[model samples]
Target: MFYGVSALGRKWSNRSPEEHVRRWGRIAYGVSILGFASHVTFFITRWIGGGHIPTSNMYEFMTFLAMAIMFAFIVVNAIYRKPLLGLFTLPLTVIIVAYAAVFPQEVQPLIPALQSIWLKVHVTTAATGEAFFAVGFAAGLMYLLRTVDFKKTSPQARREQRWVEFTLFVIVVIIAFIGSVFSFRGAGYEATFKQENVVIDDKGIESTTTETVEYSLPPIFKPFNSQDVLVEPFLGVKKPLMETPSWMKGVNAARKLNTITWSIINGAILYGLLRLVLRKRIGAAIHPLMDGIDEDDIDEISYRAIAIGYPIFMLGALIFAMIWAYIAWSRFWGWDPKEVWALITWLYYTAYLHLRLSRGWHGSKSAWLAVIGFVVVMFTLIGVNLVLVGLHSYAGV
Candidate 1:
């Protein structure tokens, strides 16, 4: 399908600007949708099959991050009809999903620490806000690309510059997403290893496929049939697999509740997607597509997304974090490196909004601020998770 689209784009490139844009739109939309669908299936299956919330590890976190950003773009494009933006947004999604591909695909049980209902509300809302930032960042790039002038330069030169900018944007997006995912999911999963050796018993050398060697098996059995430590002669069978920890039971219950909440949220997303695609109001739809985007509207959308997202991020990073810390570690707002980065992230966005509104910034300047704000948001969201060490350092990226 991409081949056919690429062929069509080549055929149309020399035709006219309108045809060129139409061709790009079709191809970008196709690729972005394919990425979106793959993300949905992978994460949803992980959620259901694992009987856990979807943000448990790097693989799952990346999957969710990609989906959230794609969802935001889909929403924006459906309403704005700014398909050129997909040239920015869709490629970004592709990159994140590509990164996720490097991680293992098997489902793993959620650890006790991550097993909280607050995780679903806290993580999803935080991620959803980041998704909006993804769209805002794309819009900011579009504003920049369109506003930049290189009339004296050759068309090839201008095209190359645009490509470079787009590539940089993708790299930044990847850094931001991974960092944010890390902050929540932490540095990675705690790994426990196991070994096996055959032993003669009443059941005679019990053999099993590697597939049946469950990680969830008892810790004692994890070592396997060893002669080093002699067992009591009266022992008939190996110790039974340990029951799920009492602390984990609540987490499991929270997961069940989270699944229901996710269902409702997904339904809302589907409805928003429908309205965004079909609605064609003048300022909201036609203008952005026709190169008629009102600076006010662009400003408004960026403002709304950042305004809503930044605070939510702060809450996730700071407030809920404080509670989780106090519960687990008897500290609430430790000046951990991750916490410090979160504060830096918040300060960064706050400065952005300040420069935009109080300072009366607009156009390219405001767009640049929006771009920078999201960069901070992304870093806070994914970068800190991957690069910096901190209390909330679970990103496993």
Candidate 2:
């Protein structure tokens, strides 16, 4: 709040020197410093209490990522002196922290595979590198909002406007999704399914077992070949709309799908309400505040942050990841979903840099790439864990 107010005040001060908002800006920076200190303290205490670095699971990893983002934001803001950077960066931090809460918070003993220093090093370093990419994302998105023309109804401008609006909508979906999860959880909503699977051994012996899955959200999709052991009705709906496809090979696929469904439904409804009230595209609504902002500085921030992050990402996500994988699984790469996606993310930024430097992709084109690159990063981070069962499956909810 202080950062936001101070940024706005700084804007006002720029327009009218009589406002004298320097005092407020200093106070905001001080509070931000204090907040970062507290965040680090939490990390230290959690590490000490857990007897392991807290990057073992979704909750711990996301919190650590959020802290890294703040750390990056502080560094960038110090260098750039842009209070408005916090307007984008801090909200992203809050959203990530809130999204982390959607997962179970219980602390569990580390599995043997995770009991390695390499595992800790790989996760932390990778998250730190991704944090810089996230800062780049924030700046890139701000650049779009600042430069995209809200009033030009020409075809190209209209296309840009729609994509920008879509990006904002995705953010809303995340927020609404979190709200939906906690809302149902707080109301004690519960449903369970029983899935049966048959496994054949080397001796040609077949064994069947039933696996149970639970859902806090209404089950829009249930497990394949599963029966409702118990279902708590929501809004008069007692059964799932459909079953998860058999091709989806994850134990948690159904629950994850249902959660996504709720997020979209909730997001659409909330977005609709907001659109009606604002009576404009969300990006258009926001574009006015960015009127006097410099797009070039934002572009530079986006590029520099990504430039710094790419090699770190290469080091941690790929190099250290391969080392850890070799140590744990006796192979550097087995084409695990997580590993594949991390490579995809790295390739994406590689292309972004290539286009920016070699092919002359600049300004809005570069910004768009930066924005989409983070989406790839997010899928590599959260989406893979949620939708794909892999060696890193235990790292997720």
Candidate 3:
């Protein structure tokens, strides 16, 4: 409802044949407040029911992300009075909520690693920081759309516009991929695997062992074996033609790779269908709606968001994270993928600040950097946990 109202408000603001745009904007703001209130209620209910903070898994973190985005949007909009900011931020909150819905929602007991007070403080503050960065991303996108000369016929200008559109398309693909995975799971997709190994002891005693693993996505192809193979049909085919490589590290690596392949294929299909229907990139379609917004104000908001978020991000994602790491793992920094990515995110935002403050990079350049910075933030939050195997893997599942 918040998304619908905010979208309608943006549309009416753009083409105000009547003076009802402000009314719609007010309605949208009220709806956002209600949504935020409901989100808080849900979080409190879960925390009470579960006996702890609800930041242990993807579902919980994603919920926090949605709430944080809404909270940040409310604060920024209150300060800037930009109706379009709400219009931009609410859709992202909706997307995060939708993504959270894809994961299992049942509250479970915390694992040994997560049973710490730092879980609440570190994760919540980090999420809040990222939420502010999300606001920066929205403002940056609006700044670029308002300032960029998309009508230019020059090759370099056209290339830059294409890059922006490509980035938008990538976001669409990610959403589609998540949606596809959820649908596939709902439709009862499954995969089976068997492994056999021989072990020789110090006394030269040998033993043979066999193990089986089941997964949610059917393997593209299984390792060649004389033993009977369990095959499940998918899209009227028993299996894909290509086999996952045997060189992958973890036992579940092949399954992960297969799922990723399916996601990419689904993402491509969705992107093609969207391109066919829209006749232009999604970013291009939305560019005109930013018609009257001042580019300078948008740029300043983007800069201010980073300036505000960076310190909090450093404190939570780095300082608090390191403290937690020491307590949890007996190390200040382990170079774990999550830790490395968190550090990378910190450094990226630091560069964003230096570039903006020292080098006077503003308008399109700074805007693009802000957009890219958010992408890094997301990878740190989601990609590191999902694609990479590390101590952080349990946080995602």
Candidate 4:
């Protein structure tokens, strides 16, 4: 709604309508504030219900990310008074919130590894830092769209530009796919599978037992020992086209693969629809909206956001995370996928800072770095947890 109102406000501004644009803009801002407040209330409520801070799982972390994005946006807008910032930032927040909503929302008890007090401190601070990074992503994207000279680009450059825009469109489609899956869950979609496990006893006697497991989403691939007997009749395909390898350790590995497959399929469909409607790349479609905004201001906001976010991210994601790991696992670094990715994120941003400050990389170069930095952040936060199996896999819940 905030995004729609902002767009409406922009459209009305062209006709010099009677205060409607400004009124809608203020209302949109108010809605975002309300969203922040609602997130706060939800966090407190979950904290009270679960008897811990609400950053222990994907649902909680994503909600925190949404809150942090709004908080950062409100602060940035207050300083810059750039209503366009809201237009870019809020959509990203909505995507985060929507993706978060796809996860199970039921609050569960924290696992043993997550019971430490540092869980709250470490995770919340990291999320706050990444939230600011998200702001940088929005600003950097706006800067690129505003300043890039697409019309004068070479043929090869235009092809590369289309690919970049398609990638962004794919990201949006992935979010929408998650949202659609969540909706399907609400509509009683489920897939059930039967598996037979062969067990060897101490006496060398072998026994086989069969068990049935149900999944919220269709499994695109069945486990080696399992057969999907029933699947919700949706998406025109009932059974997975492939079998999950036995080497995949997780019980839900097949389901995860299925979800990824479906997301790609759905995303492709949405991308086609977007292309058909716009008759141009998504980035090109959005370029006109940045007409009046100053590229330098956008560039500086991106840089300043990174400047502010880097230290916080380092302190929380790296320092605090390492300390917590030591206390919990009695090790400084265990090469857990999450920990390694966190380190990679830190190093990436560190490199971004060095390039900007020392090499005088500014404008498009800096902005592109900021944009890529957020991609790393997202992978560390979402991709690592979802796609990779490691000590932090519990957080995917």
Candidate 5:
């Protein structure tokens, strides 16, 4: 692996440094394709062995995340011919895939909530969109690095010689923040409830007959309080909460939901740990890295990523989400926390697009907006899944 990376680096270094970057970009594209194949193999194995969707839980979800990001990277590199960008993106892909190393192999039966065909479409589409955003992030980082003046030997330059390095460091910090929050959230990040129909002994089935609170209780801390646990009156309950059907008495509906929640929480924790340990923020940690880049390249790269990723994000987060919600929950849009956060992410990126195209908005301000837009995307994709609670809060944990 190191040999391939080194060869690509060498190949990329032979050109006007800029042209060399494209050669390395081609190499990155090849490597990511191989990695993506391997990732697919892992998912396929899990699906065959587990006999269910690849994203039924957190481990699978992450497996999908890595695959999606790599897919996006491959597509973008093939079209843009920007290999230097791969230096950032490939490391991230590696870190994401590494999470699978610690992933739990245990597979269980899917709950009713996850039994729809929408499960496959909804989660994978979201992952694919996020993958584009990942590449966009790399583009934005390069944009920032490309803007700094490294040629000057003045006092200010001397004092902040490695400003690009520092900027890279900040980006890593931001990614780390994203990964950590997701991990915590997947660990049963929020409180939720599940309602199920139960059949009575007297030959009648009571719909939404019972309500149970779901939790992502850590395995070591399982079996929590029951008596003092607050129970909200079920607004959608179809039967009386007090006189639940006899079949309802035998089922622990909360546990069913929590099982999925546990997977999501564990997945989030794994993602955070991987990001922290991979030393992924390497380029940003020192001087000399990206010292050969130009300002135009940075601006161009940022524009390309936003143009590509923003629309894809909209298709997945807004368009597809609305379609899926209508099919699954009978509503096109809900004021649920997850829905609200998605809209927030959309607005942030929309503003970014506007700012970039606006006559007075270019250069550093554009770079800043790209950065902010990515931050919003990260929160919407990982933060809301892990930190906030709501109706569409389906991070499995």
Candidate 6:
């Protein structure tokens, strides 16, 4: 809360006298350091108490990611002294910490496969690298808001404008997902479904198994092949409105689909409310705050951040990951969904760097690439883990 308040205070302080802005900046920085110190302390104590590194589970890993992001922010802020950066990164960190709450928080022991020291090195370094990429995303977004010509009616400009709006929409949807999860969770809302799937072997022998799906949020879409075991009514709605398609494959596929449906419905409503309140597109509403910011500097900050992160990401997500993979499964690469997505993320940033340095992809083009790169990173982290069953599936839980 203090971090968020300090960020907003910095925005307002920008219009004040130089002395006042400087004073407020100092206060904001101090609060940021204090918050980061507390975060690190929690991390250390959890490591000691849990008898292992805290990045073994979803909640622990996400909190670690938030800590890494804050650490990255402090470093970048120290170098550039950009108070405005806090306005975006701090809120994102808060949102992540909240999103982390959606998962079960109880500590679970590391499995034999994940018991190696390589797992710890792989997870921590990957998170730290992704933290820098997150900073790049924030800076890239700032560059876009700082430079996009919102008033231009030209086809190209309109395209850029719409993409920016969609970016804001994505952010709003994530926030909505987090908000709705907590709201329903607090209300103790739940629905359970039982799914039966029959498998036929190569010899034509068939077997049936019953699986269950539990939802903390109201089920908007039930499992593909399932019947309701229990559904507590919400606002007189007793049944799910739809069913997940067979194409959506996973043990948790139905629950994931239902959560997505709810998030979209709530996200659209929340985003519409924001539009009505601001009387403009959220991007246009925020564009004014980019005034007086140097676009080149913002672009440079984005590029430099990604540049530093790319190699670290290479070492951790790929190198360390491959080492652990070999240790755990006797293979370096098996084209698992997670591994494939990690490679895709690496190549995407590799392309970004190639275009950036050689093709002179400087300003908005580079910013857009940086922004899109993080989306790939997130899908690799959250989407693949939750939606796909692989060797790394346990991480999703």
Residues 1-397, candidate 2: write the lDDT tens digits: 8766755564556555224345565677777788899999999998899898888889989999999998888888788876677888889999999989887777767899999998777887788889999999999999999999999989999999999999999999999999998899899989999998888999999998899998888899999999999998878998899999998776777787788888999999999999999999899988976766789999999998899888988999999999999999999999999999999999999999999999999899999999999999999999888777799989885
Local distance difference test, candidate 5: 0.61
lDDT: the better of candidates 3 and 4: 4
List CA RMSD, all candidates: 16.2, 2.2, 3.0, 3.1, 11.1, 1.9
**Top TM-score model:** 6
Each candidate's clash count: 17, 0, 0, 0, 10, 0
Model 6: per-residue lDDT, tens digit, 152-234?
Answer: 99999999999999999999999999999999888988789999888899999999989988899988889888999999998
Better of 2 and 3 by lDDT: 2
**Alpha-carbon lDDT of model 3:** 0.81
Model 5 TM-score, 2 decimals: 0.64
Candidate no. 2 TM-score = 0.93
Cα-based TM-score, every candidate: 0.58, 0.93, 0.89, 0.89, 0.64, 0.95
The 10 consecutive residues of candidate 6 with the worst lDDT sum are: 1-10
Q: Which lDDT tens digits does candidate 4 get at residues 1-397?
A: 6555555456556555335445666777888788889889988988998899988889888988899988988877777766678888998887888888887888888889998989978988888889889999999988888876567588866765765586587676777587668777888888888877788999999998887766676676776689777877666886667788888755667777777777887787888888789997777777777776789999989888878888888889989999999999899899999999999999999999999999999997898898888989999998999989899989887
Tell me the whole-model lDDT of each prediction, alpha carbons only. Answer: 0.59, 0.88, 0.81, 0.82, 0.61, 0.88
Please give the range of 10 consecutive residues that has the lowest summed lDDT in model 1. Answer: 210-219
Per-residue accuracy of model 1 over 293-359 as CA lDDT, tens digit each: 3455655666666666777777776677677767767787778876787678778777877887799
True-vs-predicted CA distance for residue 105, candidate 1, Å: 3.5
8-32 in candidate 3: lDDT tens per residue?
A: 5555455552344456667778888
Q: Which ten contiguous residues of candidate 3 have the minimum total lDDT?
A: 221-230
Off by over 4 Å in 4: 2-11, 14-27, 150-153, 196-213, 235-238, 245-249
Which residue pairs clash in candidate 4?
Answer: none
Return the clash pairs for model 5, or none: 25-83, 183-268, 183-269, 186-264, 186-265, 187-265, 188-216, 260-396, 261-396, 261-397
